[model samples]
Target: MTKQLILCDCLGSQSVDRAALSHATGLPCSRVHTALCTRAIDSAAKAISDGDVVIACAQEAPRFEELAAELERPAPLCVDIRDRAGWSEDGDSTAKMSALIAEARLAPPPVKTIDVTSDGLCLIIGPARVALPAAERLADTLAVTVLLLDGTEDLPLSRRYEVITGDLKRAQGSFGNFTLRLDRLRIVEPGGRGDFSLTAPRDGAETLCDLILDLSGTTPLFPAPHKRDGYLRADPGSATAIAEAVFEIAQMVGTFEKTLFLTLEEHLCAHSRAGQVGCTRCLDICPTGAFSPAGDSVTVDPMICAGCGACSSLCPSGAIKYDAPPVAHLIARIRTLSEAFRAAGGSAPHLLVHDEDHGAEMIALSARFGRGLPADVIPLAVPALAGFGHAEILAALASGFAGVDILPSPRSERDPITYEIALAAAMGAGDRVALLDVDTPDAMSDALYAQTSSAADSATDIAPVLLMGDRRQVARLAARTLMPQQDTPVPLPVGAPYGAVLVDGDKCTLCLSCVSLCPSGALLDNPDLPQLRFQEDACLQCGICATICPESAITLEPRFDPTDAAMSQRVLNEEEPFCCIECGAAFGVKSTVEKIVATLAGKHAMFSGNGTERLIQMCDDCRIKAQYHKDNNPMASRERPRVRTTEDYFGQRRDH
Candidate 1:
């Protein structure tokens, strides 16, 4: 029997899932209970044997950091859960608990920052001391005025350092223009407690605003070590609740910047095999390009990375690791379940399910469709189908499951090729199936069985597949399946809408651009088209579609009239495709393209003699030629372009 140790009550949620733990490893409930009541990490660590699963819920009440620090030593399959107590018993708890368990199983921090910066200058003393070079490089690269104050160091020969004297007076103006009162200059070191002033460049405000916008204009940074910006405001409560919110935002932004990165490292080394390398999918999916591999090594640019685990789910080699329990852990549990079934003279097949926001639908579908199967089919909830999906597939194959099935949202089908390969591989392995849960008027169970049969002719017996669906739909589908033909009907909408644009059946090519570009969870392409819904209320009306839509298929109606659904339908349905005169390919819908072209044309007309249409007509090379000729002309003035008071289509510029 597999050994299991669970330490609970320390966390807000389950330290170990008694049912899942028992089902997977064949460990007795008594042993699991014993582990749960244990207080110290050492006792639990001693109790767990080789390849055993040990789960600890490190709640903040008892100082989670101290508990985590105490458990810094190595153990087999030790899962450390963060903020377990406050988590719901079911629903999102699995993913949350699993991730927490994964993180708890890790090591500790080694890196230290000498200083932290605010507005491009060192905001703190310690960070400033060690990060002198980094700050200097940033200043040079950005062409901004950076001041480094030192307490002990002498006036440097280098021009970068401006000596600080106590006699120097302080001069202050608005952002750019300021005259110094400096009669006394004092050289203050970075780590010194002395106060200093940092003046931005003339256009520094513009650059800083642009940078902030480019990074996280909407989302806030969390777990304010020093200070939080954007959305991460600090309120002291239980550490678990605070940590959960911080990590959620961290996962969303992809980085915690300082302490979290150290925690991530400790978590990785702790979980890694003694000789073998653990996964690094977390590093791979980082959108900020913060995490980089350096010759069998990994490095993170904290400045760049937001600590989002987008990379964690996308890493193909499993090189990236999350502080959260990976789907791999759950898959391992499933394998154990398969073994348990065999031990009990059962021949149940396992079905692993993945979804973004919900997993109940898959569970409900299993109860509805998994009738008379050889053994109980399992549904494993996964946050991302990318990294977790692949790991689960491998786990199933190893565990002797008949085949693996992948159920993804309609939006997940954006790249059909990737999904196809994943599904085909699972099918190629044996009894793998791929199904899209399109909320429709048809019975999906029969359709799934038929498709399963056709996909695998060699299989004499075929089990009906499960559907991974939206949160509400999953509930309704579950109710309907459990109580068939009953009048307690959960009225399902034809399609869910995100933001203003409802995916018109005719217009939606299933390209999934809107879902991909949506910064908010306003649009979801889960389960595939027709069934995919959009939440119109969440849309920011940014008109990102007008900017990036390749097909011109998507349009933003600035003024949405809810009274006329038909009018909206007509907008999407009746819109004509516009072909670019330069490249015959359809660029966008005619109206959107015309509007964009007109805006560009007007802007260029003010600066260049050539019209915007002519600029469009000119290729990159031709445009360069025109610019060169314009620049070389004797009449060319060096003066900046004048901003007009008159409002064009958008708005008039305010002259400074």
Candidate 2:
């Protein structure tokens, strides 16, 4: 890796210990005061020319970026050390700055872009007055079609596109190809409109459109209506909103680049097994209806996926990963921040994770209005709020951080952030991470300040223990490392990703229905014998096994097991195989065979005959052979009719 040059803006804003930053990064750094961005550009040019550098100023990022581009240097790592670090009252803690700089150097993985092409086949479904006008505005750019919700309203002044009356029954599909189903569709005659005479009336008419200008003044076609791509909705009651919708829809005609946020590993999913449905964790929690069950697997529509990563966080198996930055990259930031802070002669690290979009604004607001974030509280910006979970939180605690918190923007429904806090609370480290609803800068400053004050209450401080693997693997390692901190993990709340698998052994028949349906391989069945085994650590608590068990023999006990035994395989149930009476071959479950024999022997007509009852216990081959011989036995058969056929015909002719 190319070493980074840390340039602090001590001359412009506040002083940062250059020596501490150098020690933490183990790289040469140039601390410039007045001429970093302007006249005294020698240090910056020299550093950038030397290979690469880390600039500690976000305010002048554009200027530095331009300079780097002019010099043909790889994008220099630009971090907001001003609002994020220098402006803090926590004093010149260069170690935390170094940590942030280190994280910025680890470039985000290159994203694969998917092109969503739109042909501008726009549909305006709303009132005649607004829908007609909106369609007319977009007609030049888009192939517009207007559907008036109520022809009862006055007829349009003029119709540029085809004006029709219809009720929008349902709508689905993504950009460039949206499927709309309309009912009682009819064309309106524009000329001499006396009550708007309808020409052709059609039922259940369907159309394909690239964009939907929903001036309908009704419920949106998709959930999270605004988030749906290519569907621009505005109230028909508002003229301004309608104009905005029309303006926005016009520009959506050509191909656009959308990042493929979540990567789906279908084989790793526990969504279904052998036609039985198992985990629907991702489905239940996905804010957008991006995920839907596709037979044994689930499909994630990247077009609709807003990249919140709630599905990825809730997924028990690491089937879905947040590729925007990945969990590993974010988790590694926690380690870097804590380790670097301690090494740089700083104490009591209170890590604060914030979403770049929501938290950035709030951080800026707090710095401008209220007291800036406490120096002890390290701000770690992530791709999405839902990207981090219990594993990351546990890792923070294990990484010697005294406290941790996440600033969640206002949400109607609680996200995985709160759920993660609950999971860690079970481990007696709930105080380590909190979901702070910080709207104003003052609220954010106060929250971090309070957290830092309480950080001393936590007696068991942890050191950074690095572990790398999939979500489940890292979660287990973090759990095991943090287990000694608590007496026992508390029972988790509803919808928690971690829990124990419960079996109703009395109802279980060694059928292995739940075992076969388990996607995480947590439930195992021995083919050599009739038995079921469970590995708790591997279980995502997706409840797919329980949901799939036909006999209702499986149930999930939502609890945190921070012990080694949780991951160990243990036999849940076992039964002996039934041996055939004649061949001595093991075929079926002994209990099942015995139960069948008890239910049918001597009671049914077929089983009541001599030696017939024994047939039930006989192997399939033995039974077939016995039946064959019985039918072929000459002594037990009646006289043959073939020999008398000619004689019988002559005797009948004589009698007649």
Top model by TM-score, which number?
A: 2
- Model 1 TM-score, all chains together: 0.30
lDDT of 1 by residue, 626-653 (tens): 5556645555678797765446524534
For each candidate in the order shown, give its overall lDDT on alpha carbons.
Answer: 0.37, 0.76
**Steric clash pairs (candidate 2):** 11-33, 278-544, 399-464, 400-462
Candidate 1, superposed: residue stretches over 4 Å from native:
1-202, 206-323, 326-331, 355-357, 360-375, 389-391, 407-427, 435-656
Q: CA shift at 138, candidate 2, in angstroms?
A: 4.3
- TM-scores for every candidate against the unseen true structure: 0.30, 0.86
Candidate 1 residue 410 C-alpha distance from true site, Å: 8.1
Off by over 4 Å in 2: 1-11, 38-51, 71-73, 128-143, 150-163, 187-198, 235-247, 411-413, 457-460, 485-490, 504-507, 527-530, 542-552, 575-592, 618-656
Per-residue lDDT of candidate 2, residues 1-656 (tens digit): 56666565645657766777777878876764555777666677777778867777777778788888888887677787767777776667676777677666665667778998998888888877677777777878888888877645666655567777777788997778799887888777766735556767778888888888888777778987766888888988988998888888889988898888888989988787667676888888887799999888899988888888777877778899988877777777777777777777777777787877778888877765667878777888877777677777777877777767877766423657677677776654655678787668887898788778766644345545886887767766776676664546568787666777777778888877777677778889887777889887777787777777778888887777777778688998888888888888876688877888899998998888677788878778987777767754545567566666888999999999
Clash count, one per candidate: 84, 4
Candidate 2 lDDT score at position 463 = 47
What's model 2's overall lDDT?
0.76
